[model samples]
Target: MSAAAPTSGPATGLLAVGAYAPPNVVTNAHYAARLDTSDEWIVSRTGIRERRHAAAGETSSALGAHAVRDLLTRHPDALEGVSAVICATSSPDAMFPSTAALIAGEVGLRGAAAFDVSVACSGFLYALAVGHSLIAAGLAGRVLVVGTEVMSGTVDQEDRNTAILFGDGAGAAVLGPVPAGYGFQSFVLGADSSGGPHLYLRGSALRLPAGTEMGPYLTQNGREVFKFAVRTLGDSAEQAMREAGMSTAQIDWLVPHQANRRIIDAACERFGLPLERAVVNLDRYGNTSAASIPLALDEAVKAGRFKDGDQLLLAGFGGGLSWGAAALRWWGGAG
Candidate 1:
C-alpha cells in the first residue's frame, strides 16, 4: 500500500520529527581514569572528543522518556491520538518487557500497541520503516518511532576498545498521514549475521545457561567492525539513494550513525556528498547506538539547516554488522 503521508507541513499525519539528548559529555580524558587509553588516541582513531551518557540511576526507559517528553512538549498535539509506540534499541533496560512497553507506560499510553525492534545501529531506520508501514496500512493514524540506548551499562569497562566508543541517548519522531510524495521515500536494510560474533555480548548472567556466568563486559573485533562499517555503510547508502529514485546530487543532509568521523567521511565521499552536509556529532555523543540518527536529525532541524522540501538521507551502521538508510522529503511548512 502507498503511504498517504503528507509532506508539506507538520500536522494530521506521520513523522512530524522530534528528538532528545542528555547534557552529560564524557571526554576521553574522563575515560582515561578508568581505562588505559588517552584522549589523543581516541581523537585520532574515532574523531571523537566527548560523548553524552545518562546519569546515575538513569535507564534506557528514562532517557527515552526524556526524548519522548520533549517531543510531546514540542508537538503536544501530535500525540493527542497516537496509536502506537515503536522503540528501537539493543540495550533495553530489561529483556522481557521490551522498551516499547516501558515507554508506553511512561507516557501513560495504556493499551497502545507498543513493541521493540533490534537491528543494532540500523534499528532507528528499521523502526522508522515499521512506523511508516504501519500507518500506510491504515493500522494507526500516528506512531511515535523512537531510538534509545543506555549502552554504558553493557560496556566492558576493562576492555578499552569498546568501552570508549559507546554512550547513551534517545530521539523520536511523530508519524501520521500526509498528503503525498513526501515523508519516507525509500529504504534499504542489510545485515551479515555471520559477522555478529565480531561484535556481540555474552548476555546477562541472569539469562545465561546453567553454570554460565554473566560476562562482566562486552567484546568485539574493533578492527573488523571499523572496516565493515566504512565499506558497507557506503554501499548501503548508495542502495538507499537508488531505491528512493534519487541521485547523490539531491541529498540535502546525511544523518548517519555517530560512530566514527572517518567512517562518516568515507561514506559521504563514496556518495560524492560533501562532508559539510552530513551530520557528524560523534565527537560529542560518541556512538549512542540507536540514538545517533534521531539525535543528529534533531540537531540538523533545530540548527535551521533542514529546510522545507530539503532531501534528507538517514543511514546507520554498527554492531551485528548491520546497515540501513532512508530518504525523506522535507516538507517546508509550519509545524
Candidate 2:
C-alpha cells in the first residue's frame, strides 16, 4: 500500500485519469522457449505479449509516480483543489511507509491524506470508490486515486503458469465533484473471503511471523478464479446498472479488468454490450492487477473511444474472489 494525502469533498470531481506502462516490453517469445511453453500457448491463453517490466530500480510506487507525472502534465489543474491521494496496489516497494507516500513526494502533493489499498485486482475500484465518495460526501474535494502494480516482481519468472500473465504498470484518476447524475451514480462492492485460498500467496508477514518469503510469489487456481471473475463481475456490473436505474442500452462503455479476454467477453455477453464498446489492452499489458482499469481507461480516452457525458460501467474481479462495479458519467477529458 502507498501513503497519500487526506481529502475533503470537492465539487464536480474526477477531472482526469492517466496511465503509464514501463518502457520495457517482454514478448511472449521472450519467455516461451526458455520455459516449458510456446508463444502460441501464451497468446492463445492469456492474450499477452511484451508486457512492461520495471527497470533495475523501478518499483510499483515509482511507476505510479510516472503515471501521476503524465496525469499532472495533461491535467495540471486537477490537483489544484485535490485534498487527498489514494493508491491501490497489492505490491509495494517496502511493507511500510506506503507506496502512496513515495508517489506523493514524486507528484509534489504533501497536504492530502495518503494511504494504500491492498484489495488485489479490485484494489483500483476500491480506491476509486473511496475517492469518489470522499468528494461526493464532502469529506474530500478532489482525490488522486491510482492503481499500480509491478507484478513482474512477484511472478516466478520460471513458472509459466503465473509468469506469462502479469506485467508492471500504473493508472490514475483524479476524482472531484460533479452535478448529481454527472459523476458516479451507483457502485456495488462485495467480497467472499472463503475464496481466498484459490488466489493467495503463502509466507507473508501480514499473516505470519518472522517473514522470510512473504509474497515473494503468488499462488492461484486459474480455472476457479476465472469462473468467479466471469459470473461475479457480470452480476456486479448488471446490479450496478440496475441500482443506478440504467440498462445496458444506456451504457456507452464497459472498462473491465484486463485479466482475461475470455472473461471480459463473457461479461459483455451477459450484459448485452457490443464487443466494439469495450477497450481491451490485454494483448499489450497482460494483467496489471489493480492498474488494469486505469490503464484501459487511459488508452480508451487517448484512442477517442468516449465523449462528454457518456455512460460507463467500470467493473473488476480478482483475488479474495472480490468483485465490484460502478456506473459513471464519462463527462470530459482530453486524454
Candidate 3:
C-alpha cells in the first residue's frame, strides 16, 4: 500500500508551549571548583554563567513529562485529542523503552504512538517537522512534541570542553490545526554526516562491552563543530526563508538552538538580523541539547515578547552534523 501524503485538511501549527528546568542550579563557580576554568573565562568564551542540572534520579523522561504537564495545565483540553507523542532527546533514561514512551505514560497518554527522535541539538526542529507531518498527513489530530535532555548525565565533569557547556532541561509544544497562513510556512532540514566524527558519544549498545574502561561520555572537537555550526545554521535559515518566500525584513523574531551565544550571533549576522531579534538563554541554561529551542521559545512567549501575527524563524544545528530551520507566523496564546 502506498503511504499517505501529509494531509492538507487544516492548517496545523504550534498550539501550546511549555518548558521546565530542574531546580538544581550549577554556576561557573561550581565547575571552577573542579575544572580549570573561571566564570569570566567561560562567559567570555561560551557566554554561559550558570545552568540547571537534574538532581539525582531525575532523567530526561521526567523532565520532559514535567514540561508536557505544564503545557497541559495551561491548556488541559490539549490532552483530549493527542494522538502521538514525539520526544527529542540526546540523553535517554535507558537504551530501550524510548523516552517518548515514558513521557507518554507520565503525561497520561494511553496507546498513543510514542517514540523518540535523536538529532542532538537540532532535535526540537526535527521532532517539530515530524509532528507537523503527522498532523498534515491526517494521521494524528494532535501531537505532543517535546525536546528534553539531562546533559549532566552525559558529560564528564572533569572535561572542560564538554562539561562546561551542557545543562538539563525540557520544553514541549502541542501541535494542532490552526487557521490558514498562521502556522508553519516552510522548513529546511539537512545533514552532513562527514562532520559526525567531530562530535559524538562514545558508548552504545552495540559497541560497548562488559568490563570495558571507556565510559559513556560526550566528546567534541569544538573548533570543527563551531565552524560547521555557523555555516550550516545560516544556510538552513536562509533556505527555509527562501522556501517560505520571506525576507529577513519580515521576520519578527529568531529562535535558534542555544548552543553558544557566539554561534547565534554569527548566524544572525549572516542572515542580516540584529542580535536583538533572537531569543537566547544559553547564558543561563548553557546548551541543553535538544531542549534549548523550545525552552527559549516558551520563555519568550510567556514573557510577552511575541505577539499575534508575528513572523518567527526557528533554527537548530548540532551533532549528526544535522541542521534544520522552520518559518512560521505566530498565532499567539493557546486556543
Clashes of each: 10, 33, 2
| Candidate 1 local distance difference test against the native | 0.78
TM-score of 1: 0.90
Query: Which sections of candidate 1 miss by over 4 Å?
Result: 1-14, 204-214, 333-335
Write down the lDDT of every candidate, Cα atoms only.
0.78, 0.82, 0.86
What TM-score should be assigned to candidate 3?
A: 0.94
Task: Residues 1-335, candidate 1: write the lDDT tens digits.
Answer: 11222222332323455666677877888888888889999999999888777888788888888888887665667676688999998888888698888988898787899999988788998888778777767788788888998888888757789888988899888877665656777777777766776776666534533343355666677888889888877777767777777788888888898888898888888878888999887888888888889888877766778777778888887666677877787765424
Ranked candidates, highest lDDT first: 3, 2, 1
C-alpha lDDT of residue 132 in model 2 = 74
Per-residue alpha-carbon lDDT of candidate 3 for residues 1-335, written as tens digits (9 for 90 to 100): 01112224577788999999998999999989998889999999899999999999999999999998888777877777999999999898876799999999988897999999998998899898899889878899999999999999899988998899999999999988888778888777877777777787764645532333455788788999998888888878877877787777788899999988999899778777888999999999999999999999999988889998999999889887788888888887552
Question: What's model 3's lDDT at 87?
Answer: 93
Ten residues in a row with the worst lDDT in model 1? 1-10
Of the candidates shown, which would achieve the greatest TM-score relative to the real structure? 3
